[model samples]
Target: MKIGVVSDTHLSDRREIRLPQELLGGLSGVELILHAGDWISPRVAEELEKLAPVEGIAGNNDGMDIVSRFGYKKIVEAAGVRIGLIHGDGYGKTTERRAFDAFEGQDVQAIVFGHSHIPYLERKAGILLFNPGSPTDKRRQLLYSYGIMEIREGEITAVHHYYASWD
Candidate 1:
């Protein structure tokens, strides 16, 4: 299965709103989409669902409506892989450790998280820690980015799709 991973969209309620075309293009043809949160608006998921089925959690910036609807953590099974999803909050410089703790004692093969808007991919202690970054808001980063993961035959490969800028 091919899965598109994105986070920290930070979209607003403007009716004229639209997602970055580059981000949308990169996500094309994926079997599923995983959002790590900070969507800010439900419309983000609604729009993403047009491309593929979406599973997501709420981030720190999310409003009560969103938080109540999506919560802060999720575990999903896809393509014979167990995936943990969360929007890493607090811990300042130690966000990664907090993310790991969120799924501690679980049998997850991968953990997808977001908050710092910096793309990250690492394998630690036999678990894949993936942060797709912010396709719409790169924050201090030099480029906007997202992630893609392919799972087959009990193996998983992840790659980041980076763009110099978003128009």
Candidate 2:
């Protein structure tokens, strides 16, 4: 299964960041989409939903409706693999660790998260953790990016993607 993963689209009504039509258009063949949140408006969610089925959680920038219901750790199954998703924005100092730690005991094969707006993909303690970064606003750099994951036969085949604009 192919999955398009994105996060930290800090879009405001007046100033919004948009996914290139090519990007969404390219994802037409993907089986699912995962959003790590910071979607400022329901319109953003609605827009993404048009592309594919989305599994999303609220970020620090989202409202109560998202915050109250969205779980810090979400378990999903893709291509027979147990997957984990988290929006890694929290109150404590070790926010990322704190957020990820929420799924310590669960049976997850791959974990995806975002919040620092930086891309990361690595294996730690027998678990694969991935961060797609922010597709709109970027910190410590002047570019935007997101990610992709491909699963085959309950094993992650390849799970990383990034995109940015020069203009």
Please state every model's RMSD to the true fold in angstroms.
Answer: 1.2, 2.4
Candidate 2 ranges with C-alpha deviation above 4 Å:
15-17, 91-96
Q: What is the lDDT of candidate 1?
A: 0.91
**Each candidate's TM vs. the true structure?**
0.96, 0.85
Error of 2 at 161 (Å): 2.9
Q: Find the 10 residues in a row with the least total lDDT in model 1.
A: 90-99
Best by lDDT: 1
Per-residue lDDT for 75 in model 2? 87
For all candidates in order, the CA lDDT equals 0.91, 0.74
Model 1 clash count equals: 0
lDDT of 2 by residue, 5-60 (tens): 88888776675546666457656777788888787765677777788888878787
Give the clashing pairs for model 1: none
Clashing pairs in 2: none
lDDT string for model 1 (1-167, tens) is 99999999998897545888998999999999999999999989899999999999999999988888788999988899999999999865566778888999999999999998989899989999999999999989999999999999977778999998766
